[model samples]
Target: MSKSLNTLFAALLLSSAGNVLAASSVDLTVKGLITPSACEPTLSNGGVVDIGKISAKDLNADQETHLPSQYLQLGVTCDAATLMALEATDNREGSNFADDMAHFGLGLTNDSEKLGGMELRIVDPIADGVSPWIIGLQNGSSTWIRSYYFARDNILSVANTGGAIPIPVQQFTSSLRINPIIAPTSGLTLNNEVAIDGSVTLTVIYL
Candidate 1:
């Protein structure tokens, strides 16, 4: 089972990693509880990167297609700074350039064909003063602690890390850089159409 903030309308490329068959269709679902903390998170461009029209012939058969780096901003603003930690839930898990959990799966290539993987990196963290009080178990309250960009602790995960100690600030901002990799086209069967369906959800935990 995988996760998605929203179902991916299209996949980057559609082809079998090998000969694995794809399902006719898959369902997408999200579950969470809303709170009164008054905090909201947003992504620039709805978190989609337009690589434009890429011709299969232009793609390399021996090497994977590593697109030019795409960028997006992830920010959170609150009516009143609250204590919370953010985590990333992979809608399509275990699908990556490698078996890297930091990277997310790109879903099936097409008709059961397998696609490639992508990763989200945290950079340039800017929180209000007195913010980032370090996020820990809810049982124990935390104090203010700030982390610079690319801190391993800031790598969003279901557990500790990606989140920091909750600081009492109304706004928290950061740069979310996405690295998407397209597997080589040599082995894949090119059809008339292909899709790039990758979805991920960034959720906050009130600690």
Candidate 2:
């Protein structure tokens, strides 16, 4: 199941089966856990990747244009050694050219045309001064796999080389490489300057 930092509130109704017709009330219970240790995640350069001005005539007319890849450092620090995970949420959703989870939207043009897409990859993760294997649990899967690419609404964690579960760590750092692709210019509205607007939020989750 997918994990989240939000407190889970579940209400359990209790009633006697024999008194199904006579019972007038039932007991309700709500349960959740709150951890003491908190984690803070930060990105270098204020998490901004500024791709300078691009000329419309310089873009490909019939094919996608792959821009130069950019790298950003992501750091996560915890008050104590805590089991945690990172989740990425795209602020510009539904604007990508593809429907794949690995692709993040770059925003739209003319209010209807998709601008393009971008892919985020996590590389060389170091946890507590030790290099650990980056792991991610696939949606609907119970097992964790060795993967560094960020997926939509997926939790990314770190573990030992042979471990299957996330390990506790007070500090974690990694490089987030961004690969951006622009759609064909022939189909885009280039009459005015179209900024490449892509925003994603990285959240830390206590596991």
Candidate 3:
């Protein structure tokens, strides 16, 4: 082969080798755990209740269940400072006397920001033979109930700047009160014998 042709061939081979080396690549990997198992609510009763069994009459007594005073206090812990709003719901599948009220209070760490606000909701199943009721609040003042219906749903929204925020890396406590009402016709006793096995799902949106 000619000298020029040989030089050209050598150059082409070098370029091809460089291209091969440049084409080399590495495998990339990413992983995480989403929606790890949620912790179940610890029932007032000793037995652990499944989420599905929350509204069954078999679990509850014939009488009404009064809201626990302790429920008026709830607390949440997180890695960073956050603003929280909450809503409460009942799974009263098809009872005639399923009614409830939820009260809430927010507490934050010393250096934390002020509370933006919160909302609460109560619901009654249509299959139940009673009417529904609603109560709400905003900026720390309670609002009047607008509607009442049997076996319907109710909602309340509350907001307050009066509450303080906690310091960074510190834990804070909040509280809520839930009261259930029963219809007179259901023959349900208001003796507070009722049992409640429900979960309160709280969604905290950081502002």
Candidate 4:
């Protein structure tokens, strides 16, 4: 073959190889922009109460009996969109031990423009010596009570009440509703923001 023809052929092969290499090579660039909104009305502090430690003697006997009430009101804050829900569990592994005894209701008020017509509810209350009382008051009225029973073989039986109410071999449940405004005379005005906080009082009459 002629040298000129060989040079032309070599140039064509080199160009084809370059094209194949270019096709095999991959180059990519990815870009993204994200913006997040700031959080509002940062969560304020609150409080909690453990019913197990509360003794029956601390009630009417002590002048400072109100201590439990104070502890109950510690960190309670309710919003119109997000209501509070409370749960009480009595898990005693002994042969004859009653569950916790307690009563609860809601207290509400709206004094800010950011919220109005507040409402609360009693989600659950595991009372002792009686059935489980799960009911909410319209405006913190008509306290719901329940008797605690002993757990035997993972089953709870209501304690005997001198022929008052029969003991059930299972757990009980109850519910209640809380309305911020019960009377027509009660109207809320939230100029900036509404805040609701209160304490729960539990009066236990031990057997």
Candidate 5:
């Protein structure tokens, strides 16, 4: 039986070699572009937004408490004029009380309840010392829109005045505003001191 099976396999191989075979092998390619220009992104105040200690009595019990907005200086410097975009990602995912992707989580309580959320907005963008409009592109989308809200996993770029296309820039600066909102205390267990543990990472993507 083994000999018969081997003979059948040999006959099939010979027939395959004689006929036009269907994809006996495929070509694999790894393609990418390496540019000479490099960009560095930086945030003032070490990218830390301190909400400070809050009194339990000062918190709202029935509705969400909106804290005062804070502003941070965001700057990006490139070795040469390059087209790039800034991407934001939530380091502490799935902890925000809100259901919106633009809201970043402030961590959870000891009882595992979502603490709160924070929103980031990019405003007053200046590219190469000229005021320019800021545009954002969401993941898996090709369209770019004029937006101020910096959503998670979104790409933000700068465009010239009256232009919708993103342009190459060497220096970019903007004011990043943070609006923090705390969930009502009625649903949270606050027997112990809870820290505001929200962290987000800003990355530079070369276009």
Candidate 6:
């Protein structure tokens, strides 16, 4: 996540107002890079996985309960070989009450209680023969580094040093390991049935 990668892209804002300068001739141009390649990301289950139903008895009274680790295939396919990365945006922001950036919350209870959170990780990334690197641009700051292991805080970059990497192939694959947990029974105000709701949105960011 060096500045080379962090500053790879930026948005330009143009503002025009202030009486329009008495209708004088003014030229405002718009520019952007439009690449021939496009990429899309998807989950094997159409982004849904059912964990069945959990009874209060299933949770430990003294500690949080980790339901189980579910593994799903995450893939990104491009129209052609393209330099790209996958960006994940947490849909349920700030709901988890957890301090881990890679983990997000499960929404609220009837009493406005924080249910818990879930964590996502990328395991065993596979592209043609190149090893892609996971990057966290440090909150889009000027200093950052690439990560081989991914958390919610990082971006899955092509690991191109200074510029973009024309992928060797049009497809990339990886395992998305989902770990959802229930808060400790003692810490929650769960006197009745509650539903666990967690979500995330992923997009392919072409560099």
- Quick one: best TM-score, which candidate? 5
> Among these predicted structures, which one has the highest lDDT?
5
- Model 3, 106-176: lDDT tens digits are 21112221111122323331111222222233334344333222111333322222222211221334233
lDDT of predicted model 4:
0.28
Task: Write model 2 residue lDDT over 53-102, tens digit each, in one string.
Answer: 98988889899999999999999999999999999899999988877899
- Candidate order (TM-score): 5, 2, 6, 1, 3, 4
Q: Each model's C-alpha lDDT?
A: 0.60, 0.88, 0.32, 0.28, 0.90, 0.71
Runs with alpha carbons beyond 4 Å of true place in candidate 4:
1-186
- Per-residue lDDT of candidate 1, residues 133-178 (tens digit): 2332322324333433222124321122355434455677777877
- Which 10 residues in a row give candidate 1 its minimum summed lDDT? 150-159
Clashing pairs in 5: none
Candidate 6, backbone clash total: 2
RMSD over all Cα atoms, model 3:
19.5
Candidate 4 lDDT at 10 equals 94
Stronger candidate by lDDT (1 vs 4): 1
How displaced is residue 20 in candidate 6, in Å? 16
Taking all chains together, each candidate's TM-score versus the true structure is 0.61, 0.84, 0.30, 0.21, 0.86, 0.74
Error of 4 at 22 (Å): 99
TM-score of 2: 0.84
Stretches of candidate 3 above 4 Å error?
A: 1-72, 93-170, 185-199, 205-207
